[model samples]
Target: MRKINKYILILAAGVCFTGCTKFDDDINTNPNKPAKVSGTQLIANSEMYLPGIANNAYGSLYPQYLANTTYIDDARYTTVNFNFYSLYYGPLMNLESVINSKTLDGNEGPVENQVAVAKILKAYFFWHLTDRWGDLPYSQALKGSENLNPAYDKQEQIYDNLFLLLDEANATLTNSTGAIKNDIVYGGASLSWKKFANTIHMLMALRLSKVNENKAKTEFNKALNAGIIDNNAANFVYKHLAEETNENYWYTSYTRQGRNWYALSKPLVDLMQGTADPRLATYADKNAKGNYVGLAYGLSDAVKVEEYSLLGSNLRKQTSPVYLVTYAQALFAKAEAAKAGWIPGGDAAAETNYKQAIEASVRQWNNNDVTGLDNFLTQPEVAYTAAEGTRKIATQRWVHLFLNGYESWSEWRRTGFPVLAPAPNNNNKQIPRREGYPTQERLNNTNNYNQAVSSFPYGGSDNLDARVWWDNPNK
Candidate 1:
């Protein structure tokens, strides 16, 4: 009996030792570094990627808003392909995680709202991608190891899916309550997001104008009726904070590093100066001579930096705001729609929208100061003429879209306005219409890449000169 009792005691001691080992493991684990990030955290990660477009100096060179002072390769269109790998691996993947997350972010917001925002952002990223690269892995994308080598989807098909995703998001937000947590863009305001989604919807519809006018008109009208961003107060801007992590890219370049590589292009300066556009005060800074002189874009020889105006002081500040889509953009879209007969009231309404768009843009850039606006509007070149309405609106829209490179570049491709001349020493001898597919696509997804290249519309080839589907009016 004594031996059996001793054996039982030894067994109990062994069990206690094993349990204590497990407890020690639990206590040593780091609580701050979560095993799985919450949906809110993932969405915040996605928002961090918005500044890429705003700070794209290369993209700005394409539209002639920025001139390369010493290095002019990009301005001369030397680079043919731009990698979008970071976009997919970073923001897009993070948003996809939120969409697939089974656990709700309780008190942060309803699961529906969280998922809806993710879907909206996902659609936006895809929209930006397709505009730059015509065909992409849409349906099969973000599948992780499930589909390692995904086939590239046609741009047309991708557009269809984007529309569906946006629609689903808008509808899902209707019944959802509570502000989304970690929402840096709209600060958890669900209504603002709804308006922003519709604004994107309208803009996408307009892209189809040249290729599919009927469809474009129908979609544009639908989005307009559904409610888009109509006022400056609700403009979508990426507000950079006064911290290292969120400081404006210009601040890092000019202030921190003392680099002055970019200057306002002659084309932009001449246009603004010609019309005495009031926004020029805020878009550029005076040179050493106290004059707003611009640099000749894509110059092969280096010029004296101080002879030309650099970026405005406001633009280079640590916390300078980057406007994404603004009320001015929405108004310009409406003005174009009206002029195209997509909306009611015709040219008369078009004129009204055009004037309002300029006013809004002027107010936005000049800190609501309209000191020289009235006179500037009456200038012959600045006045709205129904006969030249299309060219007029396109030109003004380009002016208002200063520094927002991708959108301006896309607009130049679509409208053929402002009459940009190819750089004198350009490699292609013409402004590139589209970027070539990344080299990784050819190496890793050979079959799919070959198929996409061969299927290019309007006899397009996989080159910088080749036009995307929407850019091909002949198609």
Candidate 2:
């Protein structure tokens, strides 16, 4: 019995000692560092935030002018008060961190492919920044916390840099190899990246056409030679997963919270309705009485509630892809280039390409099924006639870009297609040229903001709608 008791005591002491050792280790040892994140993870977070940015671009400032859409009045009223500067600064700032940070995992650094993706994304954000605010910080913008008061670069210089960055991205896409994890769009497919890079090149060239014809033509030719998106399958898009967390950017704004905030504008609806466009059915929904309805561009509170029809469920619950660039847009760009005699193609060829581009955009919206589109193409209003100029091509492009308000707004600023009436109650009775610097700029970077505003053609006032450097009539 004594022997047994002694053995048991020994076993208990050993157990106690082990437990004490573990407790000591837990109390005194540094906590395990979190698993190092990857460049792909950083990219994923950046991609995830894009929809919100896009939503704010269209919904807040450039509200739809259609009759059945919602928030026409509210959008106009709030535009002056909304803080859009954050939209430009926030995402780009975060992405800058990911771009500069050497190792996502603190051990394994970013690869060539990761760097290429980051550069492309950076260019995209800068494109929006320049388009919206004219001149903004470029080379010095994303130095993380180290350069908080970076000086603004001219829009012309920014465009030059965009071309350079895009060239680098194209080269990287062509050469980089191995699987790219967290590539939610293309699954790290090099071919798709190449196509997207070329598409962006084409877009940038067209954007610069008004300012730098020679450079625009050179880039345009380069993009065409490199190749563009072949079809909807190769489109650059970010798909939403249908859950609230992954829901479309304006889903809540159009649905539960606002209820009936936006409706189609009269001009847009008239264009679709007058031409008997099939996309109207796909884009909008029938009301309780089965009638299609839209809202006026600027509505006052005194307006009757029944006058504003809610947007159809088609748009409200739309799970279709959100486009970054499409083959149709490339075709339209080709048509525009051809119309300007920048390309070897003549009017007939340009018309053919324009028609194809229009068809491509329509087909993309219709799930890439080209079945009935051919018949629709026979209609004179819907078809491309050889006599038409850049206006025709641009008009069709605008229609295809419907629901993609930021792209539409940008296109309008670029081409002035689908001519819209001035806002009835525009504060300055002038169209907004660009969003103002955020009020926070006064607090955070007052000197820089003051310098930028002082250089503006219209006294750099917030209300001026003067075209940006690249958008003005020069080239």
Candidate 3:
């Protein structure tokens, strides 16, 4: 009897020791971080990356709207670096949690409304990811530790899913009851969210204009009917706080860093100058000669930076708004759709949308200067030309999309308009179509990354020249 009791006590001691070492550790929470956060809080945090990871610098150089004086590599298409993990870990994860907690635990306010918002944001981030780098870890992504190595989903599938997400969001908003708080972008206005979701849907539909005409038209019609931002009053822009922590990244990069690294490109300056575009004065500052002078794109560092104009002070303002998408951009897309026969009413409709786009863009930058807007649009070169309508529309968009580089670059790729000349003295000999996948993916997620890149057009060496799936119009 004594021996048996002794054995049982020893077993109990072993069990307690195992619980302390393993079970307790697993169950412990880090009080510093959230075990669960409010849906609104998660949304506000996710909204921080709305302008995206890489901003105007990458976009401007690729589209030949801006040039780098010192670091000519980005301009020359030599050093193409972009990372996707930030999106995966940051906004995507937070959004996924919002949806999951709302659906599962039922704690988030008005599950339908919060879930809808989460879906919309998820679609937006995924759209950027798949567009920037063809094929991404989509369906299985944001699974946390359950599935660390998510499979790379095809870009086509991703687009299809994105459309479905927007459709559900639009429908859900119709009957939504709750409000999303701390909405840094929309101030929790559901109507603005509708315009934003539909606008983004229109943009995504236009993205398919090159690859899948049928899908493009179908989605375009759906989004246009649902409505989009009609005026700058409805634009999707994030005005930065005056505080340091959340100040505009561009302001920090340009002013605080003390680098006049960027200047307007020759193409943009000349085009605006030729048309006497009103936005030019807002877009750039005059050089020492009191005239707009731009640095030639892809110039070597040997060129003296002081001779050329620095970007306008507006961009470096602490509270300058970051353009995510604008009413003007949506108008331009509508014009393109009408021109392409994706919508009804032909060239006349296209002309209307095209002109409205230019007018709206001018006013957005020029503080509602009606005379300047009217005069600028009335310029012969700026007027709607039916014969070269597509080029005209695309060119205006290239200018209108200033500072919002990624979209401008994507527009250039899709429309093949504004016919950008290849950067001179580029080592690659061809313009980069997609930013290269991060080196970390190659090292850690080796197998999946290899499998994903292998599916690219160039047999997956992760080259900068590899065109993203949508970049090929003929595909």
- Relative to the true structure, how large is the alpha-carbon lDDT of every model? 0.85, 0.67, 0.79
Across 119-189, the per-residue lDDT of candidate 2 in tens digits comes to 77778777776777777767777675778887877788888898898888778664434656666677767
lDDT of 3 by residue, 284-318 (tens): 98887798988888865646667777788887787
The candidate with the higher lDDT, 1 or 3, is: 1
| lDDT tens readout by residue for model 1, 175-279 | 347787777788778889889999999999999888889988887887788889988889988888777767899999989999898999999999999999999
CA deviation > 4 Å runs, candidate 3: 1-36, 103-109, 174-178, 457-460, 473-475
Model 3: weakest 10-residue lDDT segment is 5-14
Q: By how many angstroms RMSD does model 3 differ from the true structure?
A: 9.8
Models ranked on lDDT: 1, 3, 2
TM-score for each candidate, following the candidate numbering: 0.92, 0.85, 0.89
Best by TM-score: 1
Better candidate number, 1 or 2, judged by TM-score: 1
Q: Model 2 Cα displacement at 332 (Å)?
A: 1.0
Q: Which stretches of candidate 2 lie over 4 Å from their true place?
A: 1-37, 57-72, 75-78, 81-90, 104-110, 174-176, 302-309, 318-320, 369-372, 457-460, 473-475
